[model samples]
Target: MTKKIRLADVAAVAGVSTATVSRVLNAKSTVATGTKQLVLQALDELGYERPDALRDRSDDRVGIVAPDLNTPSAPEYIQELVDQLSLRDYAPILLTHSSAGGTEKYLQMLVKQNVSGVIFLSGVANESDYDVRRYLDEDERQIPYVTINGRNPNIGVPDFSSDDVGAVKDSVRHLYHSGHRSIGLITGPERFRPAQDMAMGYRQAMMEMCPDTDQTVLHSHYSVESGGRATDTMLDLGVTGIICGSDLLVLGAIRQIRQRGLRVPEDVSVVGYDDSPLMAFTDPPLTSNRQPVRQISSAAVNTLVDLMKGGNPPRVPFTFRSELITRESSGAAPNQSQF
Candidate 1:
């Protein structure tokens, strides 16, 4: 049998007076956002079903945590995710992980907001050092949540992610078909699961494409500047084709290549992941892998809604394959004399 919860129990857990807990649950305007969040988290943690007043108010709001937008594709995914969330009669409240606090902080804070659910669009859940206890708490408290582009198995929540390994292999194979023997792969720090998968795919693809030629995988933070810095190292290694983990990184790679007096496709070919917006408008259109944003976002929303309805879904990740888009940025490799 479930234990009955009282206002005093909630107040004690939240470190506030019973009147304060009542005020928070009654939707008083005087309560601060952080204070209200604390009360809400406490109520949920105690396994107390919120009073009708609080449940109705919180049901109108849903929390969404956006990932680092340097990837370009993230912004697009966010817009779509927000749109989908709105259809469920929930106003999406956006949150982002900052250098000062980290993803865990924002997630803990979300509990206080009394959000109907929380959607994380690629954050620390992708990292190996993620605090499983934090996520487990959400689940233990019966909070509905979903993670996109990453997941921890112990979190026991549905994860929506793209096919990182297959995407890299396709990019490498495409470059190989363009007659480029000296190819390079650049991704985020090896600690990220996506980066590790990409590195593995690159090695496997390169081995099959050019067994005698040795290729190097450059690791860096997922940003334009980091991609540019990695480009110089790949250039020195005589890479005629480059594969980047993110579309923004590809732009950075092009800038660095031009700085060294090299032309894209003419001197070197490039392929990028996460086919960003208006990439074709650049001086040289970019070749990229198209992530299924609509499919993934729709599925994520559907899964989240199911969880909210108390329906149990499989905890396994739902993987979406990326399609390669070829364009002016990639072409036949330059002659050996050019290298």
Candidate 2:
């Protein structure tokens, strides 16, 4: 005769209190859906007979929560994430974040649908004021999840991301070496972690590389129009080289320079971040810092698969280095050029 698995056995495997497992078994509405599903998966893995409701509501979907999907980098990472998840025989359902609370709302919706797991690309987890309690709730319920790029230490999950600070510093250093003394930065709002880190790196690099000059940072929207405006502002201030926070910004800055009857690398040079797709095909073939998208994406997928199989990945963020790819957009700083 087969032995029956007890609540303690399920709780042990799921890493939740036995009482919580009991609540899950009893279909209590107070229990978090993801937590309940965790207990159910644990029970099934432990060879325990599952209740009828759980057995009937089993789903094979994976939820991907993204904060925003307007950038080229977003599509690049999403495509790779989708391709990797496909190999595991899991279909991806995109949950585009519509508002600040949308991430939590979508998480709840996905939990109700009983997804296999979740991967967060952009969400509240990256916010500066993030609360770990929300993620702790996910842990209590047994939902496995992974994050790409930004990470919160209290979340205690694997976060695959690139080195934003190093990338910006390297770009600044390169421009400094190319004879640019009056360097400036144009980045998005300060609320974003990437922008904040990049700004910090630029300030540090400027203090170390060109200590005699004052560093300038122009805050702007992450769009073509805004990039152009920000670039014009820096140009008016006599910046010989501009480091842009995004590829779109690079394109816009270039347009602004051309509109002022100045040639790239001759009058004012430009450097961009997030080596977005087709950057090499731009009129000047933009210079940019490459994000380890393929590496980070594959690592995120592998980590999620391990979590689903009851394996634990390191709770720390796995950081990858960003490489500077030089092209036509950046060159030696002109001495008092026609700006």
Candidate 3:
């Protein structure tokens, strides 16, 4: 005859009460981590199969969902996030939305594989209009997730992001001090939270510093080509300084400016966001906002791990400050002293 397992047997082996073993077996959140480990060890020693949730903990796998690898900012943050996860003894399974079937399909696959948790890097959660019902619906199975730089609050998860508004405000101030009077902003679509913050900062700074000039703000996709098109409009508006949402956008702006026979910093000065690697090597170099990738990645991993271990979600999103890295791309207005 096959022998059946008993809670009393597990309790005796773990040196805890049957209630504690029962709690651990049921995957109760109240069970302490040490207590849970002890009960699991007892079950293992007694040759009893662990509950599915308990078994899932041993997987130590985390799913990372991000935008296309082609995007300038994607790779840097992804690399840091992977490093952080690995340092915490978790294996990262990277899934780019550019892949076949996109984020929804990959998310389901991760769930089926029983990943410990999922991390989203500038994914659908960052888009204001994207429908997240599948993830938030009560009828569906809930998955543990955390987001980096996410804007939407309805996703109901912990978010770690940069203080975009402050960064833009600082960048605008830098340009104004550089003698850029007719300043313009070229950023991503307003639907993205970061773009919205950038625009808000631009508007606020213009009102404070250049209340006499019209606020020249143009929204576009976060790409080099889009930046070029927006730069053309700014040039027509007599803008002598420009702030872009990303470093890639700044490159496009510079190209368009050169094509028009205007030199960067002489005809127009420029600033960029997301100071990715090797920005200093650009022809004139780049002056941009540096996202604190390492700190954000560490905090993101810690929060996700906590959630996987049954910790409560953070009440508010964690926002980190960004720094402006000044470089050659930014300078004084036309005929102005660049001091």
Candidate 4:
């Protein structure tokens, strides 16, 4: 017969009262750090089964916060992260901040629930628009956090991102190889680091490809509408090839090009970043740079787990590689005399 270990036995070994042990097992905030550790150690040593409440702490419940689940890219990556977490035996709870109030409200809800850890995906909290410190309370701010695709030098949290600069370089290089001399770029808002890095890459590539042609780079909000407007302006400048920051933007540009009675690849070639869902099903399959979503998400989750286990993760940012996927949207540039 197996021996039964009682609460009093655990309390005696931990040098605390049974009531104190109960509080610790229940995850009451009043328990001191040292006392909680002692009780946990005692339970382990005595082969006593830990209470359900204590076992269900944040080490088991991981939180995922996203800006908008409606977006194609955000949801795809979130699903990948959740699948990885399930393989690790962790329960992932997803929260959205698409309401009127914003991410601050969702963050408060997570803190109140005492989640194990949090992963922020393309949300305003990861952006520079708002001071993240202002929204977090003193205690809540101390929780383990990880950001994807963004970073803050001031905060000590781990960040996983893609090589935005390298992606842009690859896009420009492809256009150059296709005999595109006069290239145009459509990018996101100036505040985003990825946008800034891509813009720099485009400028550098343009200078290297054609030293005399005027560099035509347009900046706009990361949306389909902005892409259409930017394409109209680039066409006015007589560009032979265009590089867009997103698939949605590329779609808009394609629409604008058709409206102007121009053909894709034959008249003007285009490249896009972020190989979003159903890109291949477009009228002309998109050629894009694919961000390594699986690699980045795994790195972020593993780093957060290390932090929770009292381990110090590297303070520097971890960047994953991106690959260029060529498709029908891009082709050899036509001769200037062909027009």
TM-score of each: 0.81, 0.81, 0.82, 0.81
Reference-based lDDT, each prediction:
0.82, 0.82, 0.82, 0.80
Off by over 4 Å in 4: 1-34, 37-56, 128-131, 134-137, 337-339
lDDT tens digits, residue span 73-109, model 1:
7789889988998787778878766531675677667
Model 4 lDDT tens row, 124-163: 4556324445433244224577888776566656788888
lDDT of 2: 0.82
lDDT of 2 by residue, 53-89 (tens): 4565344578787766776588888898899888878
Compared to the true structure, candidate 2 yields what TM-score? 0.81
Which ten residues in a row are the worst by lDDT in model 4? Answer: 133-142
Which residue ranges in model 3 land beyond 4 Å of their true spot? 1-58, 128-141, 336-339
Model 3 worst lDDT run, 10 consecutive residues: 132-141
Model 2 regions lying over 4 Å from their true place? 1-59, 98-101, 122-124, 128-140
Q: What is the C-alpha RMSD of each candidate to the true structure, in Å?
A: 8.3, 6.8, 5.1, 6.6
What is the Cα-based TM-score of model 4? Answer: 0.81
Per-residue lDDT of candidate 3, residues 1-339 (tens digit): 434669999999999999998888776768889998999999889988776657744358888888778678889998998899888889998888777266557766776667777788874556522434464222133457788888567666778889988898998899999878788999998888888888998999889998998898899998899999999998877888999999878989999999888888777889999998978899899999999999999998998888777688674688999999999988887874322
Better of 2 and 3 by TM-score: 3
For candidate 1, what's the RMSD?
A: 8.3
